[model samples]
Target: MNLTYLPLFYDLSSREQRDALNELMARNPAIQLIDNILEQIQELVRVLFPSETIGEENLKQRVEVYLQNVDLATYGTWVYYPWLEKIVHLLNEEDFIRVRTSRNMYKIDQKEIATLGKKKIGVLGLSVGQSVALTLAMERTCGEIRLADFDHVELSNMNRLRCSITDLGINKAILAARQIAELDPYIKVRCYTDGATEDNLDDLLLVGGKLDLLVEECDGINMKILSRLKAKEFQIPVLMDTNDSGMLDMERFDLEPDRPILHGRLKVLEGLSSIAIAEQLRNLSFPEKIKYLSEMIGIENVSDAMKRSLPEMNKTIVGWPQLASSVMLGGAMITDVARRVLLGQLQSSGRFFVEFADLINDDPDKDFCRS
Candidate 1:
């Protein structure tokens, strides 16, 4: 129904406001009270809307009855704008999310947010990955998102993860799905509550699956080895955000798949067995690797942080940042890459390293060595 918020909020402040509205409706011959009815109905919808619940179409007929008798405001916004803003801030709620615009301020056209009417995104890991999913939901970037992770949100992860303390024991993927739905009912979310493996991975991302940009945020060597190789074989772009020494390393697989260049080192990702990947990581130069990891995480609690139940050789990568540094450079770099990719303006180069402390934003455009 066509309505504006002015009359309803005013109905709250002074008895004079509500009484005036009723008296005016009773006496006025030109302006119908239909607008008031529509406002009340919308308010009811906002109040009664349930979480993980669907609304019936039954109310539309009744709403249409009032709408047809009324005239919508010529301007998208009106005197009620400030009042509604006040209520939202005062009430500190967002269940009834709506955006407003003013007729006079039409000159400024912001870049349109992606209309995620029914699009999808697939996410791996729910550490930083959970935060990424929540941000995407908040922006309404995808109609559906498939969250894949075998881990559970644990007590130690509460500070940086999006889950609540209540969600501490839930499987990450399932918990992430619930979180997304709770954040925005309109979004369709699913989960691969089990580990994303070589066999069931593709099934989890087919038609009834998530087939959008795949986000690789898992922190395990096996998870990453499978993810990258699978994406390469499938000819899909796989993006990885690695937290290293107060920086983020962003890489996209299959950069030039048709004319694939060679980098022998990246063979670390080519169909390696879980044990092989672990051994390869362990064989890295320990002193240098540990130093780099220490710088990234900024702490001396490598053992304490390992409560995350990582690989037997997980210490290889853990030194990369899990506890050596206490910064969030990794998240910032991930955000930058996401922006460029979404804009269809991703750099030609497939990998980038961003150092937050140094503030270096390297162009991911130059030719990389073939090795």
Candidate 2:
């Protein structure tokens, strides 16, 4: 497989060069804020390799030689795009390269924000959904994003949505689009000033050539239902990370042809009771969770029956202490799942909740109600 990856060993690789750059940034954080960042990266790459096809094993030695006496102020930024160069120049060099957990993680690298070239994401529900979108933007992950929302930003949303005083009264989708473009001019944004629905959901999910992922955080119960179905029908995994009183629901759906049915409409077609089956499926999961459901309903393979009934595979968080605690657990776990998905790791298809609170009492982090 042509692994779509930043070759880890590539140090005398981009990995090592990032470390050298990180060292410089560590010493001087407030470096021009925008242009200095890229300038430094270019400087490290040039100094380490000097030529494009330089030997891989010798990169570290060359980098160590270049840093014998380094000067950040003298670096130039002509190689990287002007917009990225400008944005990077504004940061304190040190702050830009700091890794979150350094002790165990083998590589301490400043991830090139996902949108260096161009990528798009279709996000629903601007409230918590906005959080996911902004987090992506802040990291400079995607190149383009299509934001859909029918609601306007209101005072209540200030509790969780990312917006400022000046952004009030604007439609949530448009507002989110503006935030993304503003944070990084390199980002090209499209807004669905209209709300999302089954009618237009197809256009949004299948549009823009490639939707890296679809994040569902919408409040409309039916729209939420449609979003998941469309994601499955389109073979796009859907990610829903939410916070309730204290727990976070992290659902994963990998559109599968081997499953039962994709959505309720099929059940309606089959003359099978969807509401009843959905209620049943919603309470079952893997054999274990299925067993848990069986214990409750007095039957085995409950979820398997539901899955056999449903026929598709797809993948898909939130909290409070009763909400706060779940929120923390959900938020934390979703990142783990997302990284796995982004990196092509194994993740089961279905709903998952990280009941963090159970840790103190000895219950495992696995608990479920399926559908």
Candidate 3:
């Protein structure tokens, strides 16, 4: 099914555009109309005047004061989503962002919010990346997000992916873009359905403008290496989540251009060109590929469960297992680290862990009431 994720906007104050909206609605009688601009304006007023104590009556008065002489009907813009056959009213971009991120007051202050609004992020996969993208959108961490994935949703992917059954067979990147549009239509999203490869990696990382940061999560070993090579070439920092034991990887290519990829663990392929590396990895057998992957993410550092599961791939299990809980944790960790890196709060680059087992012991006979 062909679908468009971007929403159309109409400014009621403009007679021509308003007439077009009316004409379109008249033609499509089944289109669902949603008008909550007034309530949104009320929320905006509350956010604007945090110090003022406002009840329902005073809130409306505050909205009127902020609107001045502007009519309630034309104060904001109307947005239409083609895929859902629905139309909604929302505040224009500026005020919409202001009220949406109002709760982040002291934590991400006004100055940091503005700074983050101008940053762009590129995500290379959609499984765990889906959660990361959604969290970033909900926090309004960046103004633009780019997604790249060559795979489609599958029934098995539901174990960890945040998608409906109907989304099966849809490209992962496109599905993520639609979800983000529904959440906040103002954020910019670009998709690379062909996935990241040597040919298109440049376009993905440098086309419109160089991305401020890159998040690599694809399954291909070749892509895992190629993407980092390109990121290092452009001096863009990279982040990744291994989806096991809360393992997170951050490579500050931007800060240390000389830093070897994957902390120099794959030093065996150090001198090879990108093409040579791709060809060599492609020729490797299944076991060889796993050997290289182990090098990429320290084999010794992975959980004991993962270590046992690796030998069972295509045997007892079709593939390495991933849990929804671990994926959610990875999303949260990556999003937090991304914000810190972009905002200049975190600088060092290395592997880190936020394992739950460490925080909550699983001993069967441990005292439960110990303080």
Highest lDDT model number:
3
List the candidate 3 regions with Cα displacement exceeding 4 Å. 363-371
TM-score of 1: 0.54
**lDDT by residue for model 3 (80-120), tens:** 98878999999999999999899888889999999999999
lDDT of 3 at 21: 96
The better-scoring model by lDDT among 2 and 3 is 3
Q: Report the C-alpha lDDT of model 1 over 208-246, residue by residue, as the tens digit.
A: 844646677775544565565555555555555555433
Off by over 4 Å in 2: 1-119, 245-255, 258-335, 360-371
Clashing residue pairs for model 1 = 245-296, 293-319, 293-320, 297-324, 297-325, 297-326, 298-324, 298-325, 299-324
Candidate 2's displacement at residue 215, Å, is 1.4
Alpha-carbon TM-score of each model against the true structure = 0.54, 0.52, 0.95
Displacement of the residue 222 alpha carbon in candidate 1, Å? 1.9
Error of 1 at 94 (Å): 17
Ten-residue region with minimum lDDT total, candidate 2 = 1-10
Q: By lDDT, highest first, what's the ranking? A: 3, 1, 2
How many backbone clashes are present in model 1?
Answer: 9
